[model samples]
Target: MRNMILAVIGLLLLGCSGGQSSNSTMTVSGVAATGAAVSGTIFLKDSAGHELSMATTDGTFSFDVSALKPPFMLKASWGGKTMYSFAAAAGTANITPLTQMIVAAAASSTDLDAAYQAPSPTTFSTIAANLPAATANLRNSLKPLLASYGADMDPISGKFSANGSGMDGLLDHVAVTSVSGTVSITDRSSGATLFSATASPALANSVSAMNWANDSAAVAQDPDLKVSEAGDGLAVWWSYTGTGYGASVIQARWLNSEQSATQISTATGFAMMPKVAIDGNGNAVVVWMQSDNQLNNVWVNRYVAGSGWGSPKKLTSAVSSATGPSGVPSIAIDAAGNAVIMWNQSDAAVSSHFDVYTSQYSVANNAWSTPAMLSTGTNSAYGYKVVANNSGTAAVIYNQFQRTDGRGGNGDASDIWVATGTTAGGFATRTKVSSSANPIYGQGSLAIDPAGDILAAWIQNNNSGYFDVWASRQPAGGSWEAPKTVANSVTGECYSPEVALDAHGNAFATWEQQLDTEGRQYVAASHYSAASGVWDAPAEISENIGNTYDQHIAVDPSGNATLVWYQIESAAVTVRSAQYLQSSGWGISQLIATMGAAYDGYTVFPVPRVAVNSSGKSIIIWGTGSM
Candidate 1:
């Protein structure tokens, strides 16, 4: 009887085990090509069109893709524009072929989306008609996977087509204007055969190395910021002491052989206080305070994705006399590559009191309108920051006080004010954004979600000998909501609040807070759900480190967020990070290995930044004044 029971148990175990999948994850590596890496986002789409992604930096990225199927699609994007697309299949020993993507400047998203024409072939043989050259070895290696998608590559034509289903369904939705380069897949586990899939070689390869730049500083540079669209990121800052105290912009990109930072700014001036914005098509606008011959003026420059930088032009058409100061410039760009620049000027109305002014960049004419005063005040305004949606709607915020000591209204009894603007009328009337009748302290950040909802976070005096962070939101075509406390429930002072929102209208806010219990400062983070209309309880992102601060957060369209900051545990400050997924909440916080080191006593903690894409890939950056 005992033997019978044992045999029955064994049979049950075998039955349960047989139902499990034996497949392991396959790792795929590829280069984004220098130009694509700067202007495109990288994506791995599964059979079901689910995307797994990584930031394509240093020209290479590897993914442990779920091996549920055999074929997958690799895609690159620049905002709404699709830069390039490739196909991949599984290989042995967890290895897949290295893909090389040669990309170039794509057309407007509207034109690119309309480029798809169909009679979509379902089999490789059917679409293979246009192949410049294809190989039989490639067909055998890829047929099974292609059959699954109803998609296949013609070895002779070196082109891919679909049967109007599966992965092809998603691909059909995006336009493919052209194709070039060699895309191959192999089975590396053993003596597996290789695949030769060459698309059209006649297609031009417009991708080239990026003109990236960085300011290596020995002293701390204030007001440095970076932003990205698609997969490319642009970082700009004026050195506290670069040559002639000049400003610079760097285009960080991936390449076939490596990654690099190329300088794109060659303006002749004592430039400082730089502000930059890039559109989805990789076009960028950089504005800085240039003191030429001691005359403070706002100058602007443009960077086209394929072409490089353009000569600097003055954003403010109102000429500032030798004594008149035109500084504190802030700029923002829309998806269409239109830009708006705002600044505080002493010469706008010829009063010692600085008034807020703005100018809009018209892409159609490629010219900035004459400066229009947004804030008509006898008092000076400072802390100019601007944010805009791709729809030509934007807002600018600044601290207003009766006096301006040239410190951006910081450490003063200032009230934060905001003004709404449109491409049609520039900025409209001024409105107060700060909820507190009390003083609004320090600089704040603003972001617009995909749904057109706007969020602004700033620090305010809590009257408890410490400051607190507060937030407010304005829905699309709606009024500004009452201010809500973001991270002040704890028993510490919070400041330097930064906020971002995902496409779903989910919001993530991070700030530096002093812990009353430990007497140490750390970074605190929390999120809000528009569906629930409530904020999550705040959580400490950095635990008992000697010092942890200067964190920034960026969220993807999928409501996932990547938050980065520095930990001064030792003499060297290490860059650490945490990720938030809608499914799992915050993941294990880990030290990112890509950033360089920062030593205390010898170096200032580099301000850290994080940016994430809809596919969950993120670019995390931190640097010393010394690049």
Candidate 2:
């Protein structure tokens, strides 16, 4: 009888402890995505590198962890790359590029994947203690992008779907990529660099440098940035405030090679507005306007593939007759390494009258031809651009004034004109491109494809109180099509139109339109199909959050277009960019950078530019100042 009583006592004791064991076991589940869903194998690991559970997931994963760990790690191994996540007390942990970045930051070892595969005890403890701080840094770094979503949206612990909404939507616009020990965060839609840091144990501290985007940095104004791609390499040029005569100097950064920003201009003068073009053999030529004590002239610098930048050469020597400034230079290189550079030189005989001049560079001889006038009329031929096709055929476009009275003044009317030829020969065979009687306010944009097809866009006064965006096309060996109003706002005014042409002659145009004098300016866009030969209806690409200005656009060979602009929101200003995929219509506008709030009544203006390579990779750059 006594033995039976003891057995009953033992059974009751076991029942009392059952609830405790069940409470210790935690079930963790989440979705893995890389913009879209990630189909792979998910593994739940402890700090000691032991896999507690494994599950095959088609984006959604579940794992019942028995031995609960404080710093639990989740990894999803896909085909190309693997993503990782972290959980303090397991409930939900989504494996994604963002989480992978956090994991890399928290890990002690430089090799992220290797460290996660088999973490030592000391490294594991380091990760456990550093995870919280690393996560806080990430949140602060992406504060501008997370403003629309909840600022406290936890990428690791928050529950989310892979359907591209809320947190998932934010992920779609950002690109978190890791190479070796370096992690880079960029706007996925525009390829604008947001933040980058080394994935070391000190990443938690270094990530704070990204605050420079919000809080102003010592970086100079008017980054007049330009970029070009040669094969898999990229060359970027910009002018920044340096201690010199004009307080600015030109700098170049080489990407996918020895990554560094080198000053390409001498300290004797100030260099500004540098344009770069790279050939197929990875060589590049950068052209810019330099101002000396005497006059403003055009300068050129050559960069060899394996070699570095060569000596700077002055391309423009003032003629005895025309001694004024020579500026607004444009450059293009053909397949054979020959280059054409065009600029506007002020005619000394007539004040304020500028003429277009051209200079050709022969690669075999490594010499530049003497500058020669290319414009025909006596009026100012400003805002000229030159583009080259693969076959060495080059085209130049500019805005020239025409007055019925044969005089230059407020009564003069302007029209767009084009000239076609080669770098070997001068740009001859000039033709009129626009038939508008209205005056042109600014220079028109020009774009050309590999087949010598051309597209141009400009803002023309609609004879009303506002301006309209007009575009024209020239088929290969065909005449210029009639100018059409691509974007006309009956209620608002439009200005600053920019156009881009893809490899197949499809075109994209973007501009800023103000709904009313009291309303904020909005960014608008239109698309033209080469096959249908029809311009699509204008679409508002901006979110109408603030007044927009300094808009720019570029299109890749795959027909993907990226548009960038400055948006003034409340007291702060933001640099925003949007992507138009050939497959999908348009992605949401992404905030690339932002500035702190400024004093009331003070306005800030930032100019944005974009360039794309043949493989759909794009680089966006902009100028930032006090907001």
The lDDT of each candidate is: 0.55, 0.69
lDDT of 1 by residue, 364-437 (tens): 99888887777755566766778887777888887677454433344557677878777546876577778646
lDDT over C-alpha atoms for residue 378 of model 2: 67
Give me the candidate number with maximum TM-score: 2
Residue pairs whose backbone atoms clash in candidate 2: none
TM values, all candidates: 0.62, 0.68
